[model samples]
Target: MKTYYKDFLIRDWQPGDRNPAAETISTVLAEYSIIFEPRGADIDVLEIETYYQETGGEFWVIEQEGKVVGTSGYYPVKRGEKSVEIRKMYLLPDVRGNGLGRYLLKELENAIANRGFQEIWIETASVLKEAVNLYERSGYQPTTGIETKRCDRIYIKKI
Candidate 1:
């Protein structure tokens, strides 16, 4: 992992990061009884390059002393003209409430804006209360047409 996202030791994802990132997402979702669907909505976690980087998108891994504690990324989508969908942003339970999620979302927006994207979209389940609050507080307006089965809410923010 290469450090480039401020002072938090956040960096782009790598193939070696697959397992730890998956574990972090799984652990976070399991807290709310959400299943980690490797073959469905989460397949992008396992194929970061294909779903993200390969299509003008990017993925990042949050590191704590060389351990993957979180994951964040976005992929270009067909909505809002020059829009991208924010996906796979999950942090270990211990890392919550420390402003990491807010920071990550900000940095992700910066990265997205720097890439010349116009808007950012997100789909999340209601059970992830923290995530739902983060998105709403960060100026992501709730929208319709949720594409993910597990996600009951859809939000969009113009960058």
Candidate 2:
């Protein structure tokens, strides 16, 4: 297995990443539930992927030395509208301490902004304090949560 020690690359998710991407999502959801019980494994993986594939969402991944370290996504909030939402951002446990989280956020933000979206919104969990901090530090502000079965603490950032 490849180990990432220093530099990382953020790029659009491609067909080659599907299996590793699915594994990463499954692993992160399982790990996240250990801290806060939310986002069922099936929902985060299968359901979310079905939704993404249907809606033409763009997915991204962070790779280091041929290993997938993180994943994120950008999709239309509402079709024909200039709004978008960020989804399923995750980083492996070993890579969590470094600044890769913020780096991925900025990279995704820039990618979506370039597509003409005026703003981006993300819904995390109230218990995921580290995620919340990263969002706030990256210019996201708390917003009223959307009524969905998914557990979320919604935040939005204007691009």
Candidate 3:
């Protein structure tokens, strides 16, 4: 599926997108002073589609002039689960505040809802105030009981 937002094209991630997607994510992390630890197992941007597909999920990339600028995806919380978790939602600083994040989120929500998901969850760090604000503005409420050393905030929205 392909979606057009101005000059950007959003579509399901292709095999060739791995490198660019990874680079985009790495760049954002570095900008935020977030360390990339291979042992943490969270830097799997290169295999987004492969990882999400096992659970009937999907990864999408937004590109401009054939270059990846943003990415997001959703996967089931667990096997046969009705709840899904949003992952790898990131965009370059240059593209921020242009409504592209909201667009990407809406598309992910639609895809999750179509797959019969009842709720959507996202984990983020408090350092990312913009993302937290976006989630709050989008009707996601804070939730407890999830503890992660790296990610301190958790939000949930029922669809």
Cα-based TM-score, every candidate: 0.94, 0.78, 0.92
For candidate 2, the TM-score is 0.78
Worst 10 residues of 1 by lDDT: 1-10
Error of 1 at 106 (Å): 0.6
Residue 129 accuracy (lDDT) in model 3 = 82
Off-target runs (Cα >4 Å) in candidate 1 are: 1-7
Candidate 2 stretches greater than 4 Å from native: 1-6, 34-56, 79-81
lDDT of 1 by residue, 1-159 (tens): 255444357888888988998999999888899999999989999888899989999999998877888899999999787999999999888777888899889988988899899989999998889999999999999999898998899999987
Residue-by-residue lDDT tens digits, candidate 3, 1-159: 699998899999888988888888878878889875544545456566557877788988899888899888888885224888898899999989889998888989998999889999898988888888999999999987454467889998999
Give one digit per residue, the lDDT tens place, for model 2 in 85-154.
Answer: 8887888888897887886777778778887888787877766678889999888888875644455678
Candidate with the greatest TM-score versus the true structure? 1
Measured on C-alpha atoms, candidate 3 has an lDDT of: 0.83
Q: What is candidate 1's CA lDDT for residue 125? A: 90
* Backbone collision tally, model 2: 0
lDDT of each: 0.88, 0.71, 0.83
